[model samples]
Target: MKLNTDASVGEEGWIDLGVVACDSAGRVAFSAARRVRAFWPPEVAECKAIHMAVRLAKAQGLANVIIESDSQVVTTRLTTAALYFSDLDTILGDILEICNGFNPISFTHVKRDGNTAAHNLARAVPFGVEQCWENHVPRDVAPYVLMDTLSLD
Candidate 1:
């Protein structure tokens, strides 16, 4: 599956965060993003992405899944619950509940440059496409997406 996150800032400095999920074949499965009424907080945005990813996975009845993200904090929180969720406890609580449904799910940190597909999708949200796909990514990003899967025998 494919998982991605993004942030959008308004004139007032509030930032919207989002996360989207896709299946193995690059089909958009689910997505979630919201504009925070307050100030921009990268940590909160990161958590929002993780929360959406796990929630989508659970909704799709996926098991033994691998979730990918460009944010280290989000990845760490998914794997180890590293951050305290005081103010975001409600949201974090929901994410943790979804995590309980899977057997072998995991979170992996990918370089931001390596996560272009999701980033592109996130940017498209403003245009009303919460998720996007193709038979393949454009030539420019194909290499990055396939890099992890390519190996020399």
Candidate 2:
């Protein structure tokens, strides 16, 4: 399984977050987006997105997953067991706890260009609401998902 996550912080301090999980064949297993009130730094938002994605995967009964993010800092932190001092420590701790629920998980960093589906979902999120899809793609994100699938070629 592969999960891609992204977040966008609005000027008003609202955060729009998105995550999409795909199977080995690149078909979506789950996808979600929400506008959250806790507005944090971009990296923090990115980490939050990852956290939510992992929760979704666990809920879907996935055993192992590769979590990918455009934020290199977050992925790098997840790569090591070493802890660093940061305002995001709590979130990082939660991530570590969540990963333990899975058999084994890996984290990787990708360029923003490589994460179009999640990015588009994040950008398209509605304020104060959440949208979720299971075993299917949302209508608004269908184009982005198609683009993402094409890029896999």
Candidate 3:
């Protein structure tokens, strides 16, 4: 499974996080979203989204996954082994710790346009609410998921 993650920060300082996990055929395995009031930077928010994605994936019994995000910094940090001094160290460590149980897990950085489903979910969910769906996504995200499925054809 491949999980696409994204984050949208509202002007009021609330960060909305989204995660959409799909199989190779672009079928939704599960989708999740949450809104939190945090003033973290974009990269930090993106990292948090991935962390949330991994946690949800595990909770859903997804044993293998590739966590994809638009933040190059987070993906690069997770993909590379070199240690860096920054705010991400703890978050990265937490993510890596969670990966021990999975057989093979990876992280990738994709363009924002390619990750519209997750991007939409991040913006669509209301503040102070968290939601998750299995086997399908809500109406707002279904179109994007359908577009992605068609693209694979």
lDDT of 3 by residue, 30-65 (tens): 999999998988988998899999998888888889
| Candidate 1 per-residue lDDT over residues 1-153, each given as its tens digit | 666565555556555555555556554555554554556366566666677667656766777667777877667766786546475556656677788878877788877765655554444444323342334443444453455334211
54-102 per-residue lDDT for model 2 (tens digits): 9888888899899989999899988885577878878988998988988
- Measured with C-alpha atoms, the lDDT of residue 89 in candidate 2 is 79
TM-scores of all predicted structures = 0.66, 0.93, 0.95
Candidate 1 RMSD computed on C-alpha atoms after optimal superposition onto the true structure: 4.5
Better of 1 and 3 by lDDT: 3
Alpha-carbon lDDT of model 1: 0.59
lDDT of the candidates, in the order given? 0.59, 0.86, 0.88
Highest TM-score against the true fold, candidate: 3
